[model samples]
Target: MILTRRAMLIGATTTLAGCDRIGSNARFREALFSAENFHKWAQRSLMTRDAMAREFRPDQISPIFRANGTANPNTPEYKALWRGDFADWRLRVDGLVTRPLSLSLAQLHSLPHREQITRHDCVEGWSAIGQWRGVPLKTILDGAGLRSQARYIVFHCADRMGTGRPYYESIDLTDAFHPQTLLAFALNDRPLSVANGAPLRLRVERQLGYKQAKYLMRIEAVQHLSGIGAGKGGYWEDHANYDWYAGI
Candidate 1:
């Protein structure tokens, strides 16, 4: 049964009597582990468990889409690189791995890739359809050679809040290896615009837009996001009360 925010908020007779209460409590615990500092443990339990985010047809692609999140991170490091057309950018893959990888966009693009048109639904209740082209996440993970204990895939990005660095987000192994989860380097059949995550982004089609983190800088194989930063698994999950597992 799905325990929506509506149902959880009302503390309906059924809600008060069951696991949502526990979930709420758990969410509180996960907040301190987050970098942006928000609570969301209960949010996951409130939603439908094991749900899927929406997908779409190729022709459903939107014509005039607005990119979400920071248009450009205001750091000298990012600026210098971006000004250079990200020629020095590399996607770092490390943590709980056999061999760490620091791969350039050219290197990543050389791998097998896929293109799919899918709908991106934001939490604020807007949606757009676009075609994404990139390597499937599984391909990268296979190359990374995840250790037996690695249970989550975390994305470290390049935008900031206040004085904090750009935040990171993560997902469990199930979603990480999903065939539809692509490291999107192109959107709408063209290279992703700066406002749209630039060089690369995540496309975990089974989850909400936030899970599809933009301006991706690194990918790490890990057993938990817990000790990483407050541990709730995402930026908004830590600061804004959004569920880390916003599945559909």
Candidate 2:
């Protein structure tokens, strides 16, 4: 049944993969230009979020859950901190803010925390229910003081994609404060595995897997995405056709 559902989702995504060529129909391009229209169309054709994605009962937990992304960053800077158990790994919260913060792992955990058993829905069609513990991003943002012009929050990571200098991602303020959003440090009641973004990672629950960026090193509030690395929202969004608005 899972495989059948998976096939259907792929078939649907393929159907929407329209092309843009010289002399492309003006009407077709116009319709897609309004991203809001594309968003509605995509949601209609893809798998909607299932209730299984909610906080799961302990009995429903999965053992041997798969981890995603770089298990450990290869940078000597990261390795040296790992040897020290990340006591000095500070998360720089800068960009358009009144008072930027330099947060340590211990300082992050000192803030108010929330725990939720959310389902991780990968664009590849796998799903897992796991509990995550972290501080609300709003509390962190408010404490840092956002400028009125700051429209989005970008997460700079310590990992790289392909030959790219480093991997980075961002989201607008609305999604940043969504009740399900968190800067998670623990997964399934234990310190998160390095593969799953040890120390800290983002859990923006309403989006797809890749949007849940890992290896968080800095947080920057910005007005527009135009100046950030190729002016694209993320690596997958830039290289692959992963939609920027990946709301489920």
Candidate 3:
């Protein structure tokens, strides 16, 4: 039988709650992440891969869209961008494309854009509604003439967790081109704040908040993920054994 969204999320939470135990045992760690992969595979098998997550009316916008992960990217480069109001910031998109792009915030804003009011669901068990405005990720990918061989899109972010490793995330092309996937620069009708991933952030609407990587610095389309950090496709996946395909 197909599981409800709540049921799926609850199961994920239960799995996450036991991560420490899994981490302590090498065999168990493998088993746990293996199960996470199966969870992702099962969800894809049972549900439409491109189904949109629930969107909400503007009235439902949360008064406080609590920031998840890296409120402020303390790196010198990020600090400089924040001080200059991101006037010099550019998002680099390269790899496995006929054309590469280095786009500034203004350039991104000039492109055809989309606005959506969507719910942000965190793995830590909180949800918030917010209006996000940005260009669809596919718009950028298409503009770059994404190569047919490209299988995954990786995000390199500026934020570093306490462990001092930089944040990173990846998604398969299926999610990369999803209608609701955005490279959002604005939230709630205003410029995004430092506490909320200023400059740019990802919005993979169907996934949980952690998959919505913040402080995006670069996007690379690659044929495979084996060369990326730890070959697991993301920071948390490499460090905490969080599912690489965090489909919500």
Candidate 4:
């Protein structure tokens, strides 16, 4: 009874349509939120903090790793960086950190790197296995000297959604420090292309594809997500009612 994302979404749509009729019921809304929280709690309780997501062999990599979401930011600023081959681009790490950092692409490349071939399960019902290579996110966080008050790591991207809102996503400290959580710069041994989030992207392997924020411009350590877009922790979470914790 393993349901695919498409199947689950289909079932959820039907159920939600019914719920909409009673959407004004406070009890029902509370129950829905409670269920989402329970799902997250259950998963975290069952898995250890250091648990690793399943990885595949090089031979299992997808022949064509389809790029999801904004293919290219194509904005004036992003375009300028692209034109310069991203030499001037810097990933700013600030917010609730004792030592803020502005890391260049070259600096990131010089850090210790991790490579993994893992399946990216998109909520759109598509999955692709790709080999990602980059520095683990914990490495950057440590360098920034994350403040004790910080509870979540937010990724600010260069792309914007249809509504012109800047794309962003956030993860709790648990996932932020996970061994497989990487700020990936290369894929399949090649530097990422514009369509595939060149300068940098996130690889929170335990979560769905959308959690992998691309075109990362800034990484902010925040005490809470209340000030972020719609306060839902991500662009899709705010716009599409996507669960904040999209663990697979």
Which residue pairs clash within candidate 4?
none
Over the stretch 75-163, how does candidate 4's per-residue lDDT look in tens digits? 99999999999998999999999999999999999999999999999988899999999999999999999999999999999999889
Relative to the true structure, candidate 1 reaches a TM of 0.78
Error of 2 at 127 (Å): 0.7
Q: Model 4: how far is 142 from its true place, Å?
A: 0.6
- Every candidate's CA RMSD: 8.3, 7.3, 7.6, 5.8
Give the clash count for each candidate.
Answer: 14, 0, 0, 0
TM-score of each: 0.78, 0.81, 0.88, 0.91
lDDT (Cα) of model 2? 0.80
Off by over 4 Å in 2: 1-37, 40-53
Question: Which candidate leads the pack in lDDT?
Answer: 4
lDDT of 2 by residue, 1-248 (tens): 36687898887766655443522677765566467556746764574433123567877776755787567777888788777888989999999999999999999989999998878888888887788999878888999999999999999998887665677788888678667789999999998777898778998887788888888899999999888876777777667646677774
For each candidate, the alpha-carbon lDDT, in order, equals 0.80, 0.80, 0.90, 0.94
Q: CA shift at 103, candidate 2, in angstroms?
A: 0.4
Model 1, stretches more than 4 Å misplaced? 1-55
Residue clash pairs of candidate 3: none
